[model samples]
Target: MQFLYGVQLLIMILMPLIQMVMKAIGIGFVSYLGSNLIIDQAMNYIVSQMSGAGAVVQQILGLAKIDVAINIYFSAITTRMVLSGLNKLQDRKRAQVWRAPGGTSIEA
Candidate 1:
């Protein structure tokens, strides 16, 4: 249980950091391309639009990352809870069943 929670927490923390790094890398690539590749008016307009579009994309990616983290956290918690409940029920079932010393069923 502790290990599971620890992993989940670690993943949640790392997700945003990863997202930020990826966004930075993408922005860097775009800026490098924009500076090196501009040729004419149309190209200039396109590069400017790309810069603006990158901002919008970064925001969308951030929101998407958040959504993915939330879904993962919820899924992990819900799955653990459901599986633990099933295990408890199974234990109860085993306890209720009569068994002989040799592991044979004992008819009541």
Candidate 2:
């Protein structure tokens, strides 16, 4: 019916837009968590462990004086992971279909 066709057309038009929005939201959320939660937890753990190293090591190496940039490091790692996953998914979705000699179709 015309109603069914209209509904299908609407879905076809909106599906890609919806998927793009979801992907963007997912990436942004991951970046936020990586920059905030992961970095904070890592910094806290490092500080606790460093504090336990005693005054002798602290005075010798000056660990307290050195600043650790965990946000930058963790952000780079999270970006690389998300990009790699997205690339793999894209490649899978665009995989090539070929016909074999036996007249069977295969996706590679």
Alpha-carbon TM-score of each model against the true structure? 0.34, 0.45
lDDT of 2 by residue, 25-45 (tens): 998788678667866788788
Error of 2 at 69 (Å): 13
Extract clashing residue pairs from model 1. Answer: none
Worst 10 residues of 1 by lDDT: 35-44
Q: Candidate 2: where are CA atoms >4 Å away?
A: 53-108
Query: What stretches of model 1 exceed 4 Å from their correct place?
Result: 39-108
lDDT of 2: 0.76
Evaluated at residue 46, the lDDT of candidate 2 is: 77
Q: Which pairs of residues collide in model 2?
A: none
Clashes of 1: 0
